[model samples]
Target: MASAFQAKGLQYWVSELAQAVLPILPGSAVEIRRLLEHPDTSLNQIGDLVAQDPVLRLHVLRACNNQFAEKAAGTLSNPHHCVSMLGMDNISALVDSLKPDCGANNRFEPRYLQAIIQSSHAAELALSWLPFRHQGNADQLVLACLLYGVPDWAMWRVASNEARMIDALVQQQRVPVEEAELAVLGCQRAELAKALAQHWHFSDQVCGAIHGAPIPSPAFLMRYARLAQKHSNDAASVRMPNKTEAGLLAHSQGFTVHLSNTLAQQSARSWYSKPTLRCQAIVAAYLDQPLVRILELTKSVALETSRRFAIVGVQSPAEGLLWPQPSAQRRRIKPSQMDAAVTKMASMLGQGSVPAKAPKSATPAPPSQRPDPLNQPRAIGIKSEKLPDGLDHHAIRSAPKPAAKPAAVFPGFVSAEKYADYETLINKLLHQPSAFSSEQEALRSITDCLYRCTELERVVVAVLNPERSKLEAYYAQGCSEAPALQRFTVQLQPPNLFTQLLRQPAATWISRERQQQIEGVIPGQFRQASQCEDFFLMSVFNQQGAYGLFYADRGLTDRIGLSEAEYKIFKSTGAHCSKYLMALQP
Candidate 1:
């Protein structure tokens, strides 16, 4: 089959592609097969396991979405829901039909495996970044990025030699990637991806992400332009988007997915690469945040990926920061490609013209005077303050960065203490100001009060960073059972529950009934990451306003619903903690 398909170009590959052209990780396949054999295997278990392997994840989503669409039902993007819809028999059959290469006895090709790992990293990065921009359809975005390299993966499975040649020409010979793909594969990788997407009947959004939207003919473009202009001129005239126009518009998300993929791949190579910096610059401009802040975020997401996924042979991006890889050479893009990228980015963001190029004869502006899009004004409700005539309070607060003190050791569980007199504990913590040495210690004591006085099993105090854009977990108690709470971080933009609370000093409790009522307002990510419902959140404010919040839950057990009395005490404790925080501000 390999010999028959050699250099057959895009159409042939699309038409003749084998059913199992994509390769799942050998280890994942074995584990999945083992689990499927078990009589009590749950859909959630399979979904969680399938999530680790991009190949299997795509298979499940594609199969479920296709099945649902055939019945005129909306498609399913959530993996667990997909698994449930397919049923156990269908999933078992699907797993059984995987290629011989998926057998655990077979070894993975290094380059092919690298591509899979990179795609996984990209998906994780995209999912982690949803709160910042597009919070809706988070799962769909992850699936899109994971499947971005489907064409390449399929080629690696069926045509390893051609794949090797393309990589060689691009990496070893330093040829432009598009030129290299054309020379070796008889078509660009993106074009092949687009063809395969169509052949498999992928959704237009995914199809757009695979190779961008299909290029419209000049006649089609002119007709659309005329319709748009006529509608703009006449309020009564309706500008309807036909099938072609809707398909074209659906692919705008492709650029965001592409940026995620670029960052994932380059960060794995080296954090300091020119391509990496360029990607970060683009993101910084989009988010209206400093380039340095974006760089820090890049590192943080890479660390999160490493913590989340445990793929073999692939080193964590954070590892490169410590023992720098000698082989991790920075790859520079050709000027032609770089210019095209900038122009495309400008047009995609609705900026019609490219940034004007500075003339060589012109004196270069100083870094301070130069136009930096990242340094633009903050979004509404996020204020920008000019530096005052005194010492910078922001700098003073951040200067004494210390290692996070470990979670305080508390006595063993006490009986019948649930919702007991918390007034004494709250008053003691409030009155004894000198009892705690640092701001974090004070917060930790108050967090422990919930565990000691209330039936709540988990408590976390997340403080705002200096920029006040995110709340990072500063202290926690009763979170040993749920480690996700320990690393809890919440972005304070894009108007989520956390952002709304930060608008002013406020306290809110989400009981089971309340969670159902406001489910739409609560971000899917916060639900997934916090891994709780029926929780308590009380905002703590300093003089500057909206410092942080206290989060508590009954743990995953949810055996006991949080009571109004406990909520009241939690609010009072948070209030005193806010006073302590403000007192230490100077």
Candidate 2:
């Protein structure tokens, strides 16, 4: 049987290659993501991983100590220093690209090793023939020609037979791969390589190198091929100026060069992994597990690719120069790099743990079993302490005691004369500033709401925190004391808390923290305390959606012990505020 590596077809082969190589790369993506559940995994552990890989460790240091980060003024000598300066995610991404799994080794079989080497040599020659600026892509073109014969093995082909055909074309026929494929197998190796390259997720450039017209200048090919073949005898420190020369043939066709027999022999002896016919070593380990679990492992790699490739951009103004200075950092990778990611993501669904046509119900348990407690936290103490009769779990946190009668403000302020204007002010803040649009308008609107609303005195309005999934203070007028605002800010989900309650249309729903927050409200929007507050969450909402205002007080005004009619008005007013608040969109 041919080795697993000799198989053709892009998706299947890439997936196989990826499975083979990902374990060698370390840091299975699943393991990386599981960190979301464990916040304590520090930068130290990650630094150690980088230190283990000589190439990656050096790159990490270079990037961190680069000109862009020079001003950060941190002395980072190693992976530990890397994590502290660059952050975990950033460091992980840098090391990820260096993995062997990233289409680093293109050729699958050792049978045509000589032909592959010679073809790669020819590609180098073609690159050298180009102008100085176009030399950079030589590595890409060389790898392209090396694997040019791959597409032909797409169907099942016996390994010994495949090896004989490759040898006949190269050692016997003494021809290049493109001719070798056609003369011996009746098709061009370039065509087969192109098909396989496309199948495996190779970039357009690589495919073009294998199949595109040969480089225009024979002299260039002669130079590049000679130098590339000499690469073995030359010092390891030497690197060709591929970037310089390849620039001239940016979009044009390039040709191949032949690797000397000696270099081909040396490379095969030093670099090749012994072929494993069945891939039984790794596949056997995986066979016992559910397919879903296997896919889970692969999905992590796909997710990593997406995150690495995701570019963040700032708007470049049209009125300015045609192209802005490349302020935005750009990291380029070939199209082939994505082939493995695509196949893994697509096929991973099939390998998932559960079948699509699962049984309707789980099989019954045996004679003895305990209920699963994963969903609920197990409390050690008295179950009786759960809650007393009327109060919900929200009230589990204690609310501030209402202030003394004279200090209380809501009772005197909520009177009919003052109520109408207060209602009008809140209604105005309920939406965007066209009728009221700017940030300044938002502030002004809130100021009016606090000024006119009676003893509910001071109120503060805050925006939702995008990163933290919570509300943050935007504007606050009548709030008093850091502790009061602090209590309100905790556990307040910007849209969710109110949306969930309002959907039920409960006439009076205490906030989940209502038990912990009542005395925090002060009359006429206390201005002194709201400034220091970190998370400013006001329960001020209009009828539409967002007028979420929380009134804080030191003492209970007569309004706290309101008439049923007055209480109903407060509730209805809150609903109205909700409607208006929801109208305010970013």
Candidate 3:
């Protein structure tokens, strides 16, 4: 079965796969299917069992919806409703059509298991969000989300070899799954899924979403509005002309399912990955909530989905969240490098008693109380010869400094050619003056230039609040995944770098050398927010004087240094933007 469709087109595979018997169900679903052979099996009892397994529920819904297309257009009810709609004989027939072999050795592949779990999570999220969107067929959308990855699961089972190769390529080489799928299977999974769903007569809601049909539920409408507003400040609400209320309702419902499925699919990757973050941001915008709230909702849904679909030997997104292992950058120290205290502690524990209190000479006097590090008073005596850790301070100070390594480029580093291009674009915009029609456009343009033309990983424009008591992030580039950077704010109650910038239109560069000098006046909150000590700051002023601040920096772990050239461009960009703002000021 796996080899039959090799080197074939999408339509060929769809037509062949749709008619082929489905692979054996997951272990849990297979057990539930076995109960169907019992002569005393009741429809209600079978429905309850089927509802417990996401895969089994999908099979039942697929069968029922295919048989009753009209009824499926609206919200299809629970498993019991689908079971009653399809008599016991039809249910048994559906199970029989599945590949017959089922054994205790049957184990789900990682890709297949992840797809199932992710789809389940997506379905749960759709259902959870259903209450917020009253215009859609809630049940239908949830079903669509649940069955969204049906094609992926089916392909993995029927084409194990190809799927394995694709998975290995994606994981080991970091190649995109779509690219691997195209190379190995001769077509992308999405196109294949759409064709297969259509061939199998799946519900139109699921099929349309896979086919990329636009359904404008409230969430989708909100997503559209957010994107529109992101590009233009005065973006108005999007309206569809000549469409009746019913049509709009149907569109919205379809889009809701589409977006839910999209978001879930991306969840199989790191939650902080670019695709996932973008989807989360869209969801956050739609819900009119913070990104943190959206993250919490998704995590909660993943856990609930894991509980509802308890598949053994399979790790779900919930597990990833609950017990995240350390990253490569945070690997545990090797045992051989254990400190003296750690080694002593281990030896004492092995003896089951504190190794008979140290000898009198070694114990010396009672242990001195350590000063409160955060509030320790400065010593007024001559410098100590030995450090607190008992190291000779003079020897350590005299040791030759380690040779400095060349700075490694940050992940967001722009190439020299790209920087030149950005610089050219900025220069044109500044010289032409008519290139930007609004003050907002000019500000966004400069923010973008700083991000692309310099080594900065993030560039933010924070505007003063109406009361002029604080500065809040108004626009940012390269900050979507960083909630802290997105929420950049600084209070002006006390004198600080930001307050000084606002006092007069001036630019300040907090290089490594300057950080120590301004450390006292630099706001602690800004340091916590930006997570970078060295950054560029300049006041943005119009005819009304300083009203905002321009901030830019390499990211949290940036190894690169801010060059003088980059700082010059940063300041010049701000100057041009300020000039534009003053011209536009009424």
Candidate 4:
């Protein structure tokens, strides 16, 4: 009788924690809980969720063992064991913990739930920005950011017109979420997220991370959330109009150039780039609309996109080419989360009617349509995005800006139709552009092609100067489009402080103080922001004699220094640019 009472009392308390914790956390009950209780959930991945408990293993077993209690035919000899012992249904239930609905029972116009959903999605999208930097801790960073807006639910019940603030900020203020978040919420989402994250007894690091997110750290997944909402797909050149603004966000968050471009391009289409899908999906579901219908809504699309991109890889952390993981499976952005967010939106229109864009080959506007973006919320075709030039030149030379991006015409899907043109252009530049008279000419031609094809945001080419044994920037793009920047060059000096590292017969990084010390020793190496932050490297070569390095704007993309995966890309880009430069040499 005493043992039975203990079991009952334990069950009751566990239920209390589940009820209190589930509604407060982000992600579906199935998603967050799996990550929370999953033993296989790495020490690194989902640190925000699992790191909370002093005894996570105990909790994992507890959750799993107790899961089947309600339906168990008989008591197992040793019930308190691993999740594998529980049936899949019970295990999944523990993972898919449902809140006992914090039922206010109030029907809010425009639906308060939708705003809550969108805000959560926006935070998730911010978290989706991890992969590009390839930072080891990227996944944890993402969860921290995704959970940032959950605390604002406290404010949601007070805002009478829930949708009004989000809508007005986007349409009238031209806020692309982060800015609007600043405008409306008065603080970055990271702060709000950290506050709630702390309230829930998440890892102080997670709380620290939410606090640390807008600042810098190599713990990238959370850091990149700062850049989740704003992404532009073009990388061959070195300059972007908003690169400066992006860099500012990065520095404040603590990212270096290494991550900027890598994350930026990766984020362009991947859901990992944003977390909005979950928020929007949840909002849409609560509003009672089909998944497809709500993603088509635009009133909060920018925020939605941000949310989608930020959570790009919350599932699988540390995925590389060597690993086969969910993040690497290459799937379309899932609207699984849209189910709930859509319900919130649907509730606003009593009839459940949503604004959808007209299909192609049909008139976009109806005769009696109000001049509202809301009325035209159907997914707009991503245009051929024209990139304008002539504003900035990179470190090496002055050149015309990459041609302006044509208006973007997005294909409906990521099938061959969407990537074909980019692939075709790359093939042309890769194979046929070798006929230039000199490497310099070859470099120019390649830049022009990359720009016209909208393949690169910036380009840099360097050759080792025999006398200095250093890489010298020969040609560069997307930088100081000013005539002066075109003529500039910085010596990729060998590390004086990193002498031991350089002597190791392999590539390596020295200490930061040493790197800074050695940099001061270079004659022309006075520091100035390159790609919007101090980005100077002491080239350390491995036995392979690899030379030259490239980085994107610190705030604009990911952490700098090329990875093995990108080295292959650089080889191709470098080979083509070298040929271009050789042809132009007098």
Candidate with maximal lDDT:
1
Taking the tens digit of each residue's C-alpha lDDT, what string does model 3 give over 414-510? 6657656776766756544433423444666678777776677889988887778999887888887778877878889887778888987899888
Indicate the TM-score of model 4: 0.25
Q: Model 3: runs farther than 4 Å from truth?
A: 1-7, 20-41, 65-78, 96-110, 215-251, 322-586
Backbone clashes for every candidate come to: 0, 100, 4, 134
Residues 166-218 of candidate 4: C-alpha lDDT, one tens digit per residue = 44333222335444444434455445555554444455544564556443233
As a whole number from 0 to 100, the lDDT of residue 351 in candidate 1 is 36
- The estimated TM-scores of all candidates read 0.47, 0.22, 0.46, 0.25
Sort every candidate by TM-score, greatest first: 1, 3, 4, 2
Which run of 10 residues does model 3 get worst, by summed lDDT?
Answer: 323-332
What CA RMSD would candidate 2 show? Answer: 30.4
Segments in model 2 whose C-alpha atoms lie over 4 Å from true places: 1-133, 136-158, 173-179, 214-253, 256-586
lDDT on C-alpha atoms for all candidate structures: 0.65, 0.38, 0.64, 0.36
RMSD of each: 26.5, 30.4, 22.9, 26.6
- Sequence-dependent TM-score of model 1: 0.47
- What are the clashing pairs of model 1? none
Better of 1 and 4 by TM-score: 1
Q: What is the lDDT of residue 400 in candidate 2?
A: 57
